[model samples]
Target: MSFFPAVGVGVIGVLIGGVCLMSQRKSLFGALLSMEVFTLSVYIMIFSVVWFSGSLTSACLLFLSFGVCEAALGLSVLVSLVRSTGSDYVGSLVSGHF
Candidate 1:
């Protein structure tokens, strides 16, 4: 597909991900998944721009690397939360005990 269409799709993906994140705040896993969606959409947008311009492909790779690191960090936090709180609910973090 063309760059503009790809960018439009990415924008839609970002909006959907944002809405999901806002509406599905009950679980940490769900939040992380939504954030991943957002990240992926952003990557798509950036990659399209770079691909069309034929430059800065390394910038896309750097963004992808950051996204991976973010995912790993979120997963580690989720695991720790589960271990300490025994649940993945977002409410667990608001109880002033974590």
Candidate 2:
């Protein structure tokens, strides 16, 4: 086991946890970006621990694909919400007649 990889994983874990906490006060777009940050941090941690083998390589690729897909889907939802609500903040999500 490498010392730097362990340190890097710890740093990324802290970043992921910080982003999760920060997302609560952010707008939809900001929250989605934070989520992407969190996912990328997880990917970094996984790569740090796992050697790239046949099955593991495929799994890593799939994991990366999902992260990208999630970002794109979140962005699309943000756009739709902005179009309907005229704002990106959480409190602007009210559904009744306004």
Q: Which of the numbered candidates is closest to the native, going by highest TM-score?
A: 1
TM per model?
0.91, 0.74
Q: Report every candidate's CA lDDT.
A: 0.92, 0.72
lDDT of 2 by residue, 39-90 (tens): 7777776665555322356566788899999988998888887788888887
Clashes of each: 0, 0
The TM-score obtained by model 1 is 0.91
CA-only RMSD, every prediction: 1.4, 3.3
Scored by Cα lDDT, where does model 1 land? 0.92
Show model 1 residue runs off by greater than 4 Å: 94-96
Candidate 2 ranges beyond 4 A from true positions: 1-7, 10-23, 52-56, 96-98
RMSD value for candidate 2: 3.3
